[model samples]
Target: MPRSPHRTRMRLAALVFSLTLLLVMTTLGIIPRASSTTTAFSFASAGDTSTLTAGDGLNSLNRLAGSRADFFLGVGDYSYQSSMTGDVWCSQFKAKYSNIEIGPGNHDTGETNDTSGTRSYERYVAGCSFTLSSQVVCGPVAGQCYGKEYYFDYPSVNPIARFIMISPRVFNVTGVCTTTCNAVAKSPCNDTTGCWPYNKNDTHYNWTASAVDSARTTGIKWVVVGMHKVCISAGAESCNIGTNLFNMLVAKKVDLILQGHDHTYERSKQLAFNSACTGFTTNSSYVLYNSSCVVDDGSRGFYTAGGHGFLKYAVSTDRIDIQTDFAGTYQDSFSVVSPTTSLSASFTYSPASPTIGAQVTFTATASGGTSPYSFDWNFGDNSTAQGNPVSHSYTKAGSYNVALTVRDSAAPTPNTQTMTNPVSVSPTPLSLSVSGPSTATTGSPVAFTATASGGTAPYTFAWTATGGSPSSGGGSSFTTTFNAAGTFVVSATVTDANSQTSNASQQIAISAPIPPLSASFTYSPSSPLPVLPVTFTGSATGGTQPYSFTWDFGDGSTATGQSVDHSYLLPGAYTVTLTVTDAGGQTAKAYQTVTVTIL
Candidate 1:
């Protein structure tokens, strides 16, 4: 035992490799912890690989393969040719798809010869390691597992879920008639085999039902049954085998059925069989047995199947969301309402926070009843009912818990209800101010500005000038010109965001023009002129108002009153002049040469 260290290390390495291989074989699904919410699963049916390229199939698989879902289910036919060597390919496929759960299809059994009994298939089945949680017995025969069919539990925190895989060929008990036998004349089955009954009480029926019942007993909330053949489809000859299984599962309240045999993907409404009549078309009548079943009142019993595609089931406690993706596109989807929650109601409101007196606009959303919701608003103000987002003015300020209750047209009671945090109302004073350009000149344009200091939106401005060019403008400031010579007043009225207003006024003066005069002027007649009365005029400058004038002819003639006329006595050269004075008695004079002569 105390051998070389190298030998001990080699032994340990071999043991580790063996354990790793075993782990790989046993646990096919390995997912990281972060991507648990978005689990993806992919499936392919019988004969899909023969016509579809590996790239095409792989592309479809990648699309559905979310990072969380390390598990995948290969429902059926993985190989085109049924030969012993195909098992080698299956092994290769298993190695390649180490993360998937491999299910055996008819082609994997290498039973190409239709007449070669179940010997080859049995050998292949024995070699397969995949196991089911329950076994289905063929007829009353004990220990007869339906081909290689198996069931397993999917350990998810969501409602308990289970999957059932069955071989479509083994369930094909309704034999082709080469000779006539039992019950109806020209029947397909011989007397020993019993006319392959299509009823739910048939042997194959009991076997599948037992398996499902066993799975359900384990507290599985949803049972997803996968097979190669479909009950309702547009292609292929109609087979009552699917019908029998469908009826049995409906009676047992199975959650979902995933099937593919035809090249296209298809889906049917939740279905059940009516005992009133029998036929192959969708018009055949059957008793509705499942809670999710679609009622065919017009005798159209079966809903048409979808195209070649994979079925995805999102299982939850309240409902099962089913989607069918075909050729990389989601072709069909619907939800199966759980019987327990069918009558339950729920509602929600958006933008939860709303200020009081802010008109918190909201939509009352609802589900599980007739539409056109009836709205009731309880503002926690002890005030009664009204419509959604009902505009109510809060007189007093406080935190009030708001509740919205909605009842649909078909609801027996108000099933949808929503509540929000208490709305708060706070009041504050509105204020305003004016800025810039307080004073300006008359006949010259000027501008004044005003601004709101506080409050909310929708504020109004009403400007009234006490006195200015324009006396009043309903805005912030007044712009106008003053024509008269007097003191003018300008004012601006400002309104806050809350529609509160205030006024401010400024006074401006319009000045009159000053007379320019530092000199005086006078007028008189020339000398050597005719002896007629000649008047003299005088003018003075440099004063605001109230000036005096006087006239004096050198011949001892004088006149007054700002300006006066003087008469010439004789025709001789005599100096004529006039003087003017201000109220201050500041005087100035001017003279003109004159001549008094006879004409």
Candidate 2:
């Protein structure tokens, strides 16, 4: 997995059970550490998210962010209701998951005739790309970017893992409304049997089936399918997709199927369909749907109803261990073993490729081996460590071999395995800073200067912003403009001559422009006589509401309020001024000339 330099590579697998489900990403302060052998990543997923049910899903996502979860998968129904500005439900998801992946549910589509929830889903969900379209992950199911149907690689680039999101009740691959994403693709609908509402005539099915099949060819070890609705749920479920869809999934050898809609947790057994299609069987058995492959039945996993918690998985090259959790408690767990299961080793260093004399941490994670394994680290330079996670430093700068050997509890001789990789120790002379105004007016350009120190000659800068753009080139600084009023996270990356990169970030808040204030007033009596009672009406525009009003009657007496009565005694060619102050403290004045005649 490619590690983000900003995030600590240390395994969060240890703090998994300690933190509550409400912890957010930033609260988990990251320390510089090393990556592990097996990628211990967990993703929190739940659907039927609405204003009412948002708290639980949010807790799950927040906990995932705080932990080492690679990414979050929202089954669907992200929002119960849609707001014009998308602040209610959309912002909640954005605040939690800037890198969220979504599948549309029934509620998200019905909130609007067209795309309201979908639009927000695409806009706020960053950190997703289709560049690895066919590399262990499925991307752009039918030529649509982050379309309701798509897939992506998670946590890291290795261990060969992928996540597929399907929107059965909402739009299909082409963004067209369909009962099931793939229902229209199936030929000769079996209305006689009420063909699976979702998989029948399903175009998404063909595309998905093809996508997963192709992904499998790219050496994927884990393939998880997520959707808003499920097929094998129990207890008179109204929208039960039934066994037809389940049959296809199990038959096609999909590792796991995550669903929402019923809002209940239900885990299926290792289940599969009989070739004759009369009935299906589960546990300790699998069906051969193809000449060269076979898959377990659906009864191997358990479920939790009412959608209270989340599910986390430990993915590796050979096996996947999943835990069904609700409220920080593990309700159930099971392991799915893959055919390619074996002991493999991999590790990463923080301040990656550190300079000589720099402290470096290494974490070694092992799976596919017998329980109670021991690790040995060999740092090529005659330095070694016995434990899995240990820190070391290289006195000289150069490339060296770093290997980890593991011995598991097997037979009397213990099964042993070794894996090695090249570790580079180089001089790290890089520092970066992005300086700009912390606050600005909306729609105005904010000038930012990025300065870099140390690290080779001929340095280059790449700038990115939350609401604007900067010209791409080699330089020290650039400028960008923001249209929306909010805190924008801007970053600048400096690439040295050797292609090593260092980045710095700045937060800028752009506020909406202050409105101009205009004040006007009218008097009840145009030609008021001395001491005659008169009424004055005051009004203002183009400013924030709840304005403070003041009326100067030219008699050294004043009154307040939108409308007030005043008397002018012995008035002649007097000017009356109405002053208005808006909520933002902006003020404006208007004058009225009035003549008071003696009665």
Candidate 3:
């Protein structure tokens, strides 16, 4: 059938749209593409070439390298004797596998007498560059660098997947041989004195730090650090020095540390330790995914045939899957954890300036994270405060520094921590006053009152008396009783809501009762007759003031003075009673025995 022009143009437009969509999806990593799959790589340290055959190791690496692998990582020790053997090994290595990236090993640098080994090795391997795009060499040994000890970025998978190469002997300082060499004699090349320089001026350590810092600044999500020394393993001559470099890796939070020194394959848990402490006891465990040390040979002798192998690492967006293979046999496998997404949190306390005893409410919120999180609060007063929307009351008056650390279960550790400005708890004076009965009699009731004026709301009152009961109340008044004759002191203590208290005391005197006087009467007549007046006298004693006495005779006669005389009206004997009264409303009664006889 003949297609119309208009229909043909529409079909072409649709095809263009489809291509554009495919391109966009690929760039966004949303499309399932062949390149999207992880790219695998292998690394191995082919030790001394004397006993180790490069052909066997190359064969093992070839079998381990799956179709997905893009390149290979090699650490020194390529050949034995001189750089010529090393060249032969390299030529053989290239002839067998076209996708291999080689690095300089100790043996590849030729013999101690060969001065041109370094330059020749560099020229031979310069053709095979690193797979990473951002590979750059700097410092004193910049342009002449090899792929053995360098850093690069794999942008096809992730622009931030940084791979750092480390040379075992790069940072070490060679020591002078005392027996065979003079102190002033320059150490022979390829010997310990020529390769490893431990001096601080050595650019290795500084350059390494700089590389790590640069990768961190670039927001690199994962860092794969490869070296030729096994520092974290159980046994190795350079284990301690390797530990120092390991400490640096931990400080930088590098995702994975890869190295080969011990000729055996071993793995470890992520290691965390205090750099300040040199001992292993101070080491702590971090969220380490996994670690492995691969030694192709069981014995230290590098010439062994079956001991050659390589490690295959599949780098993906999420994780770095690893598998170790020897003689084409899968020995062990593990993976590295992905980096956590960073989050930030900020805390804002309402009523920024809170007075002493005021309730301070805090609200902390996090950004760049999913909902449902936890918070840890440090009130900075030797006390811990916690909660999302937490509230606290400050009793003491001072500047309280508060910190909020926010975290979520998805994160490896706390995502964000913020310290709020010093919340000043201003000092408040508690005005106190006492009011009660100023004077009271003995065994009388008295009330003491304590009033406070300045403080926050919900004031608390505490009353303490030195010689009385201590009570607390919301109001300012406190009542008590005074029972003794001596001067009784009453005290009242008042406390506000801010927990501020004040005390006041008052003294009250209770006067004792005065004793009353007693009066007695005597008759002067020797003989008493009917209707005869008898001389009667009364004496008063023991009284506080002038005594007024009331005397009552048996015949209904009475006297109204302190002392009085009474006469008998009848011949029969009569009873007389005298009553005395004091100034303080006290009275005493006395009776005298009188006899009337007929003459």
TM agreement with the true structure for every prediction: 0.38, 0.40, 0.41
The alpha-carbon lDDT assigned to residue 40 of candidate 1 equals 31
Whole-model lDDT values for every prediction? 0.47, 0.59, 0.52
Per-residue alpha-carbon lDDT of model 2 for 1-599, expressed as tens digits?
22222211111121111111101111222221222237456565555544423344446556656756555566665554334223445555556555456666544544232343333444322323232223333333334446366676654555366677765534332334333323333333333221224563376566677767776887877777777665443323443444445556666667667776554343333333235554334434333222112124545444333334556766766566665555443355545554324666667667676787788888877776566789899998999999868889987768989888987876677777888878898765778888989999877878888988666657888877756754343467777877888888888899888777899988988889976889888887777888888888998998888899998888888888989987776757778899999998889999988888876
Cα lDDT for residue 318, candidate 1 = 45
**Model 1, clash count?**
28
lDDT of 1 by residue, 382-487 (tens): 8756675556555554677767766666536635645454666544345566554534445666566666543555566665555454766766554666656676
RMSD of each: 23.1, 32.5, 24.4
TM-score of 1: 0.38
Candidate 2 Cα errors over 4 Å, as ranges: 1-37, 52-61, 82-88, 111-143, 169-202, 238-244, 266-307, 328-330, 339-409, 412-599
Error of 3 at 338 (Å): 4.2
Top lDDT prediction, candidate number: 2
Higher-ranked by lDDT: 1 or 3: 3
- If the candidates were sorted by their TM-score against the true structure, best first, what order would they fall in? 3, 2, 1
Instruction: Compose the digit string of candidate 3's lDDT tens values, residues 54-103.
Output: 44444554563443456665644444334344445555555655555555
